[model samples]
Target: MEKTNVEKLYEWLNEAVMTINMHEDAPYLDNLAMAINVLFYHDTQNLNNDIVKKKLQTALENIQLEQYDKMEKSKAVQLAILTGMKQSTQQQHMMTPETVSLLTGYLASKLMAGHEKIRIFDPVSGTGSLLCTVIDQLQNPVEAYASEVDPTLIQLANGSANLLEKEIEFFHQDSLRPLLLDPVDLVVADLPVGYYPDDVTAAAYHLKSDEGHSYSHHLLIEQSINYVKEAGYLIFVIPNFLFDSDQADKLRGYLLEHAHIIGLLQLPETAFKSKNNAKSILILQKKSEKSKEPKQPLLVNLPSFKNARAMEDIMNQINTWFTGFKQN
Candidate 1:
């Protein structure tokens, strides 16, 4: 297939990003990439090396235009910017495309049954890809909310949302801290995984031990679960250790009591080669006041896929599982 003009623009932008000498200027690069995407979406023919360089040199104006279609070009722009940031700054703030698609497909299948409107949130929103993917996949009217600690990433997320003409309530704060908002219909995130020093908030959640060391991802899971309305869903991309590690036993017990584990998809080891972590997708429904003890969660181990064809097969199997779950 011949590459479109927008695709060529992305290639040019990516190459330009490599020539940047200062790491601190990566945020400026992010902003420039976003501007180029918006402009290209408006008029792909006008985009070229000279025009893009001119736009980046000048102050970018707000774009008021129709929403871009959900095509490769639209997705590639944000991805190219995110890739540039990662390469220059060595930051991890974006989810892989496969992870985004799997989560979005799961939500789309589950929500297809019946729902007029929904509220979705991502506590560790990163660049807002998870929330944006959900918005792109679902047919239901959705109010999206997200929080990220990085101000630059927040700007990029908000810019990407604007390019898509989607309204999102974004917070520039830590996700571990208490939020002053109503519980939402669903919470989805690819949580950051690591050890964190015990804080007052961790103490409040009872996740802090006398030893004063707590796993950050565990705390994020607990906090994200709190944001979910009763009977609502909490879906996360988490380390596979959450299922059986001795360190996570207490947290698992707490979840077994407070929420109904709906499903777990164990991803391939190569799923996040960038981070070198074995991860999985966990789906849970907040226990309703009158709901009975939770049933055993469905679990599926995905096959490793080295190419696009294999990935499509994996997605097909996932859709089958989702359909079965919805039926039962």
Candidate 2:
């Protein structure tokens, strides 16, 4: 029987996942590249069975065999398994396709134009989704940087970048500290919520200490602001409760004192996988040459959302902004 394209795509994606799961030294980047490739070639039919095996076989063979030659299988396998299984540990932290689309859409809109060399950074980069999306969507080649406290996730992000032919400086470091690198023009980060660190005993780890005064999102945001230039833009996706809490006024005041609040996009409850319904986008800008001090504070409310439609609209809006910049 001739298999439909949908069936072939299903088979491909499944096989790719299965193969990576089995290979001891399979680079995490290769899996991302394979997944992305499958996403591009996917159809409704192949999402099920046939084409997957062929795709998996090809992806597996395409890995750099020499890279694995010096590596130890046990360690590699442990890392691979840890990463493959990370999403299954806590259902709450897993990101949905809608979230992925939103991240990519924002990047597409904001940084697509090659106007003046643009550098992008994500401090709490998870599995490199936002960083990769930004890299993949940019019209100009960007010097991309990302930091993930989780070593396994860091490996996955680095591996994905290698496979995609995307260059990014990814570090397994505490995002709370001063950035060891140069200032970025734009910063986009999905701040961490309640999630355990991969390492429990590391004293310097952010999640390790739930001190009386630290590990708060407000503090995290304050630290992140240090990484941006005086007039750079920061797009932060945060929990909804953050805007209504007692700390909200203080954080808002702090942000207003330091930066310009350009836009805010509130998200639907289902935008996150958690039962906690807190999702919102804060668009902040540092003092720029084109900036104006307004008499009144500005607030923008977003329209109701249907994931697919909203994502498309957001992407279009972003493209429009970039296109306008390109024209001017």
Instruction: List runs of model 1 lying over 4 Å from the truth.
Output: 11-68, 89-91, 244-246, 290-296, 305-324
Candidate lDDT (C-alpha), each: 0.67, 0.57
Q: Against the hidden reference, what TM-scores do the models get?
A: 0.79, 0.65
Candidate 1 backbone collisions, by pair: none
**Candidate 1 lDDT by residue in tens digits, 151-268:** 7677667766766677899989888888876899888888787766646667877555546567788888888878888888888888777766546677877887788888777777
> lDDT (0-100) at residue 69 of candidate 1?
57
Residue 290 miss distance in model 1 (angstroms): 4.3
Single out the weakest 10-residue window by summed lDDT for candidate 2.
69-78
1-328 in candidate 2: lDDT tens per residue?
A: 9964334433444456665445434444445334534433432233334455555546645443334321232123233334455645543224324444445455445643445567888888766656666565566657888987776567556654654456788878877665687878788777776433423332443223343333345656776667778777777777777777654666667776778775566665555556485577777777667654433322333444555676577657755654654344
Q: After superposition, how far is residue 317 of candidate 1 from its true place, in Å?
A: 6.0
